[model samples]
Target: MCGIVTAVASQDVVPVLIEGLRKLEYRGYDSAGLAVLNGGLRRVRSTGRVAELAEAAAEVHAPVGIAHTRWATHGAPSERNAHPHVSGGLAVVHNGIIENFESIRARLSAAGYVFESETDTEAIAHLIQSKLREAGSLFEAVRLATAELTGAYAIGVLHETEPECAVVARRGSPLLLGIGEHGVYAASDTAALLQVTRNIVYLEDGDIAELTREDVRITDSAGQPVERATHVSSLSADAVELGIYRHYMQKEIFEQPQALANTLEIIGGGGLPIPQLFGADGPAVLGGVRQVLILACGTSYHSGLVARYWLESIAGIPCTVEIASEYRYRSSVPDPATLVIAISQSGETADTLAALKHATLLGMTRTLAICNVPESAIVREAALRFITRAGPEIGVASTKAFTTQLAALAVLTLTLARMSGHIAEDVEARHLAGLRHLPVAVQKVLELEPQIEQWAQRFAMKHHALFLGRGRHWPIAMEGALKLKEISYIHAEAYAAGELKHGPLALVDEDMPVIAVAPADELLEKLKSNLQEVRARGGELYVFADAGSEIPETDGVHILHMPEHYGMLSPVLHVIPLQLLSYHAALVKGTDVDKPRNLAKSVTVE
Candidate 1:
């Protein structure tokens, strides 16, 4: 959840550190800080935005520095809890939790080391400083200190004594080394370092790196030297910029069409779905998959829920979807014939990765990953993977990532259905045609943003909302509700239309606005009855209807017609207006649309 950037350069690096923090703002931070070695250690921290920290550090400049944007974990968001925690001559910025910090704190406290802030990172700084007497250099001290710590962490350490070098270590959190002409840098994400370098070295789980202006040295956990290949990054600096959009959320919402097209580009030539689309061993793995168990968290979990409907209906396979965090703790029946699928936008999701490992522990080896990042931990762990080309989604509330995930899952569904001999050639052709036309459909749906924004203006005034859908679209409704609550700060919930009269009908009133996904599918009449139930209760309605749904706008019911009914792929299109609605509602309310409260883009900690 936190961000770390460190550099050892021939020139002053304070401005570079601040700029890197600005690029990492999407990771959702409450405090920003930086420490540099300019003859002595100089540190500045702020509990506000990075710009505030930059303003405060305007006079400080150095050739070696480390910076951090922190999302609160061990303590409250305050200047005292900000990173670049210093002890002795060392300053540290950490990205993940230290599980055994209490013990380490007690030990360090017994040695008469005072803790300035209530943070796990301060313990790390003290621990590294304590090792300075026994270790030869700052890198050695950091490596020794990390051996005693137990938990996920990607830490950057700077020592005033070693003015020309910075040390960084990673275990369970992401960290990368960047090679630039004038400097060597390290960051938790490539976006933070893209301004300085295009060449990157992705460190392994226990790798420790020492960066200097001239070169970088790497060592494994056991102290042996190692070599890591540097790859040229495909991401451009302009890709992360919010071009004409007011916020990154709005920009990502509009980018969904291209994102989906890129994800589904494999089958653009119009052919039967093949297993190799997943990976080289996809054929061997898909052949033995008689049942499916999908594991994911957040929006990715909802995608799995949607996939359950597809797998059972089209592929004729029994499917179950589980929340990854919960599934990892509880015991469950594991079948050898079951395929375990893990879905995540960033495959580094802590819970999802743990759940995948848990599944492997249970002897379920038929693993697959549907993720956006190709080099993520989950993708590397799984036997098969389908990487969605959603590019980099900077917003905390997912838009393009969700749609790209659905596009990838659709391809997975068709492949399995074909393997099971459950699809006719003509039926496959029709589905392929729908997928080929999906980008156009998504663009047409984006055209309804103006109408959705008008609806959002009304929603901004309301505090509660209820979303309704049926069948596969039920998951889409859940995703919509999630988006609204994520960015707008509105309390929202979703229900399968059939479950309305069971208990949710009692909550429907004039104060609560009910939104419905009214696609003209087989369940249209049943969903129409559910809408009528809301109308009977004086609940104001906002319905997104298909073009031919014939759901007319009356006194209490507001209808925004979608461009078309996209058959099995309707969820991909139905979700766009909901995303726009959330973006506009957050905009109207003046909330931070990209970095919502108490949320992080990539959850690296449990």
Candidate 2:
């Protein structure tokens, strides 16, 4: 998905628009452009970062304009395909795709509309221009144009005839209105306007709003006036600052303790979670749930896999984990009593949202979302929600977000256990105490960075790496491999320690590095034998072992001891070093740790 920002302000709004686009660069960074209604819609665009567009638009004097940083969808990433697509007097910037654009473009072409850019967004501009020529209001023209479209979109449009007014609309995509002292703004996300204003109104599906410096008027698809509640954002501009860390990933890794502490705040002054943590209907949903189906993608999917272990072992509930992208395409048996949980950091993940809706369509009405953003689509769509407090994860490869998801899932596990009569009070109390001490344990885990860095130095030189673990820690190994491949650009794979000789051992050699996660659990001896198999084959071992495991370092074998054995919460603590290893390896290889190539922070489009 792309990022869009539009404003109808009292002062010269170009500077504010540029700053907003800068903040939204994490959403998309291929190319950027801005259009101001100065002397009949003057515009500047670049096939570069937003900074280049800011430099090009330095002289824009109009107080009304729209801007976009595009992640290419219907065309190549070039200056010609950059957003703020213009036709006649209409300029449009869009986030989602126009699925029926080919048909619409052919019709418009026959009607004597000349297109300049290879973009679905350009078709919208021409369509709007055609409607505006019918002698109707701007809002009416946009409404008529949107009725013919067939896909997801959050669009901002500005017409030269009415320079002081801007119109924005959303359908199956996110758009928020920022009410500020000097102007009203529309953006794909709230982070764009956090610096300028904290008052936000999230537009619902099929809603359109016309904005000006003095007023905003929202209406539904039927042209009926609709009331939208305004919310004051608690996120200050400073929370997003890098603040001494070399990269946001590094900063977020260090922020894990704080994030987890905030996430665990719901279990305050008591051994059990606060009744309101899951919402008003939480108890009924958890108490009535016959099973659980978790839908997620990427890092969230790995977190869901870990939660499967917790749900089955601790909560005594049957649980299944599914990748959102694949789940939507397959026909699965749905049980109405099942609790469908969707895990997403942005909560706007396209496939995950589709899968949740698919489940709902199949008579699975009981749903919950463990999301980071409170106002995300997944939160609104689900019947219940748990908001993780990991704020502003700007890294393309997730760090704090993954750890916080695990923390929230643990809370869910304990709550479900209490509801299901599977856990005793003493066991629940012990788990609560363990959760309380989790942040401190994670902080101590951060102390292993220098040791992990020494290991990363060796890893940076290897082209392929093997990550090994078993049981609950198996998902942690998958996450470790994901982080390494995502940031460091290394080819890494994960396998269960017991599955080494099954097939993967054939690939282990002197050139391959095998990373093992051995926490002194019941399977420690079995894992030791697996490591020996690798060592016998001349595979260098980089082992992260707990103190009780007593795994020694000899010749080709290297060991970094963990602080302590964290029992049930070992996955949460064990993931920290893998994050550090990935970060350090990427740093040593001179990779872009924050914005990895070919990846966006949020996968809002499939």
Candidate RMSDs in order: 1.2, 1.2
CA shift of 483, model 2, Å: 0.9
Error of 1 at 496 (Å): 0.8
Where does candidate 2 stray beyond 4 Å? Answer: none
Q: Please report how far candidate 1 places residue 107 from its true position, in Å.
A: 0.9
Q: Kindly list the per-residue Cα lDDT of model 2 for residues 1-606, writing each as its tens digit.
A: 578899999998898889889888777469999988866888899998888888888767789999998888888899889988988788899988889999999999999999888889899999988898683889988888888888888999999889889999998888999999999999987889997899999999889899999899999877789999999988989888888999889999999999999998888868664357988888777777889999999999999999999999999999999999999798899999999999999989888999999999999999999999999999999999999999888778998999999999998999889888899999999998999999999999999999899888887978999999999999999999999999999999999999999999999999999999999998999999999999999999999999999898999999999999998899999999999999999989999898777788877777
**TM-score of every candidate:** 0.98, 0.98
TM-score of candidate 2 versus the correct structure, residues matched by position? 0.98
Per-candidate local distance difference test:
0.92, 0.91
Error of 2 at 502 (Å): 2.1
Which portions of model 1 miss their true places by more than 4 Å?
A: 272-276
Over the full model, what C-alpha lDDT does candidate 1 score relative to the true structure?
0.92
Pairs of colliding residues, candidate 2? none
